[model samples]
Target: MYFTSALVSRSLIKNAGIIFSKQPVPKNLYATRLFGTSLQKQAEAFIPKQRIKSLLPTNNSFRQAVTRFCSKAAEPAKGQKAVGWWLVGCSGMVFVAVVLGGVTRLTESGLSMSHWKLLGEKPPTTKEDWIREFEYYKQFPEFKLKNAEMTLEEFKFIFWMEYGHRMWGRCIGAFYAIPAAYFWSRGYFNKSMKIKVGIFGTLIGLQGLMGWYMVKSGLEDRFQDPNDVPRVSQYRLAAHLSFALGLYILFLMSAFDHLMPTKQHAIEITQKALKLRKYAHISKGMIFLTAISGAFVAGLDAGLVYNSFPMFADRWIPSDLWAISPAIKNVTENPTTVQFNHRILGTSTLALISGMWMLSRKCKLPPRAHTAATAVVIMGWMQVVLGISTLLTYVPTHLAASHQSGSLILLSMAVWLTHELKYLKKLPK
Candidate 1:
């Protein structure tokens, strides 16, 4: 009986130990999930988690991480700084070159060099080459009649102007190429950007070819103005100027693309902006047409021919409007007609752009974009003023050159505004 009772007690002790091992104490259970419970308690303590109203860009590290993630979602990436800066520099050089080219054209220095040399043949490195080049110029009608008594030194002066212009163009090409190559080699280029830059380079090269083409026109004999010192064809000059401005805008757009400081997705905003851009295209077309007319005004020396205000030679429309046979001929040769069209185009463009500016006020836009649009409006008005002054003053070399500069500024502003309004931020993954 005692042995049986001791065995029963041992069995009971063993069962008690097994039960305690399976079920931990209350305090021990709380400790096991203490961190998770604390987190839940904190979350539940707030009446509304979102309504805590933390300051923007919260001080807490966790909040900062959340905010950064949200920001990243909105704006994928900003434009690469290094690439943007490089493009800006290149664009600036191109702008200066355009201004200089305008000066060269206004001063009639474009035709001073009657020869085209790709390489090898130098620009009068020796006295012999100088004399030879001078002799070549003497054969042209300009030397025979207009500049008959021009000395070798005087010839060299004009020669240098043309030489400098061509050299500047070469410099532009080099500037574009070296940096472009470096960036591309370093994996900076994407497929679309590569195509864009390639197109720009090709256009620049073609512009050089067109420059020679323009100069060649003046060097060759003319059927219409047989006795005149032939100047470049107005049509060709317009084409050249158009291409140059195109190149400038392209570079500007690319620069803006690279310098975009934010990668914010505004797809809906961008679609609306694109709709506005279509209207902007009309403004672009008007601006371009006005510019071409200005070129025609320059080409025929039209501004110099008609210096009067509100009238051309004692009449609103010059008596020689249809002087050329078949009437179509008057458009190019008749200085009065070309100047008349230029005035019409210029005034029309000014009116159209002003109206567009007013219409732009109806749309809501980002603050930076609004500023750009306003700038475009102001620049347009300034350009109109410059145009009037240029015409009233008979396109003086200085003012005419300044007017050209103003036009470029106006174009740039218009482009920037267009870009800003149409801007679509890249999305983050």
Candidate 2:
């Protein structure tokens, strides 16, 4: 029912070879009574008639059974293409969800609602509901320190940002599970592929739990003073971002497998080109690590701590890179160290991306891979520029958010490049 094209093609070729070969016939057929005739008629029937007899199988019954088996094996199924495309669409939606998550972080709306109410009901819409929700937030440290005087309108601003992000996550869950169930029920997915999707789905569910876990860190009195601003642990933030990216990469790879499976184009490309694609996945892994470091930078508000660029406060490494009294305090608790590490990771990402682009220039890569690499290079440069501007401008909210969004774009491009390289060429121009 789910035969691969290669399998069908092989079966057809084998059957065709068998059909083209001549089969032996019994000599006794010529001795039948109908064959008795004049000399010319006897000779005419003897030669070509014997050849026709040689072509037929000794037993037509056995030949018929073999033919039926070969025919069934070679016939194509109608649903294969539909199943592949459905997986691609589902992955693309998950990628969109990742982007929205970045927006939520950029706007500082990740921890807006201090409570994690799973299945509490959809967000409140009525006037009375809004007031009750706003009242709950007022009890948090963020409201006291940063938004002490924030108006109802301002509260709505942050509320919508977080709500939209949460809603998108819910939509992704339904989109993935419902279609997956439908496809699985139809027996469209292969055994190995189904296992992969299951693991991916599990990670997605875990990511939701991680989100709530991350938020819970900042909801309580982590700070001694009531006036202090509470923030999620940088470690948890890094874990959240890293897991999201992991899901993105997995979905991206699965989508690539559907769009242009390696088995489909396995022989088209040269060995060198194929090897380059393998290396690209390694590049993606490095970028993912850099992105997590970036989260650690953001969670500690590292971007705001040091305004200078190319150097931290006109120094290569600040005097007190680990100045915090406790040893572990500097990595996540200290803003300066976090910003320093972020700058280092940002620089490293730019360098590695540049290296990838340069390597691509000398190789014979597909259009999708080429385009993705170029886009990553371009966006990496833009993000660097934006990062410098953000630092020099003291991390203005708008510019900082744009820089954050730019990172998402760059990450998407990197993920796309790895996928395309693994799959093969895009459509011919």
Candidate 3:
């Protein structure tokens, strides 16, 4: 019932190194194959040679196709391409989810959604449902202490903002998990890669849990304003934002690891990468701190505090930077201090990345590595400009969203530069 080298010409199966690309499978098990007699029979001399040739494994056409298919599947390099694209999808989803989260914050819509559920559900569909949802929101501190004047129609706007964010997060999970399982089943991953996917999936689940935790902070009576305005805790907000940014970096790093893996050092390249590594790492830390500072500014509505650029209230050092007690509390717990720190951190990151780029120009480096270093400089500058614009413009929703997206872009460029520089062995000249 199967073709064998014993019966067929040996030259066909053994042709070059391409034909029998993988270990031989039982002849009948090949998914892509010409149908043959379910049961083999003795050769019949009376059978027409032309007709018999069609069923023979030695047929040139059959061998060519099987050669191509098996050649691709058996080669590990080709499989890596498939897995790389799958990771690109995951990374793309993470970027979108981060942007959506920023928009939700800009809209002041995070506290509108009072419940979190595993199953996907639609918003209130009827009068009774709308009223019930609105009443449920009324019971929360956000409505009682701050938004008591919010009409049902106004509530709908913020409701959709938060709802869209949650829905996008759900889509990200679907995009990642479905393709991950498919790629894994197709044997695209090695053992180490499988472990990485597991860890990534686990972190995604934790991000969801953190989302709920952040929302819960604003729903309680802990933090309040003199005007009785209710908002999420800055600490929790910073934690949520930090985790999201970190997750984005993970997706990016893993994607690049598979897609554009570091080529082996050809002819013992320059030592510039060694020095670049130190700068790249410091740049990454600056990006992370800047993002955290942005989170604190958002939490305290501190962007509204100083609408002027290059200075807060026209003062380099605002008088109220430590208005809160215990001194240390003013850094994270005070609006004026938080805004000041964000400005310093953002400006410092811009200066640090610019220095890294300048250092890159003085050494021989891979073209891609140089390009990535350049991107860090350009994006870092863009982030600062956007931050200043977001502040001067009073944190308009669209501008603020752009500012947040800019942070992630800067972060990605920094990570790429860092990864590229890590491969260099010696110090730059």
lDDT of 1 by residue, 351-397 (tens): 87777777667665666766776787788888878877887887888
TM-score of 1: 0.77
Error of 2 at 294 (Å): 1.6
On lDDT, the leading prediction is 3
The digit string of per-residue lDDT tens for model 3 on 1-429 reads 123433343234333213223443333323333333321121122223344454446655544444343332233444787777777777777888878887888778999988889866578999899889999999988887778899999998999889988888888888889988987888788888889999889888888889889999888876456476688888988888877777788888887888788864453455555667788899899898889888998888888997897777768888898888899999998888898899989888888898889988987787888999999999988888998888898999889989988888888888888777656665334
Q: How far is each candidate from the true structure, as Cα RMSD in Å? A: 13.3, 10.5, 10.0
Estimate the TM-score of every prediction.
0.77, 0.75, 0.80
Order of the predicted models by lDDT, top scorer first:
3, 1, 2
Q: Candidate 2's residue-wise lDDT over 116-180, tens digit each?
A: 65653367789898888889899887787677898877788888887777777777778788878
Q: Could you tell me how far off, in angstroms, the CA of residue 249 lies in candidate 1 after the best superposition?
A: 1.0
Please report the TM-score between candidate 2 and the true structure: 0.75
State the lDDT at 406 in candidate 2: 73
Clashing pairs in 1: 75-263
Q: Which scores better on TM-score, 2 or 3?
A: 3
Q: Identify the leading candidate in terms of TM-score.
A: 3
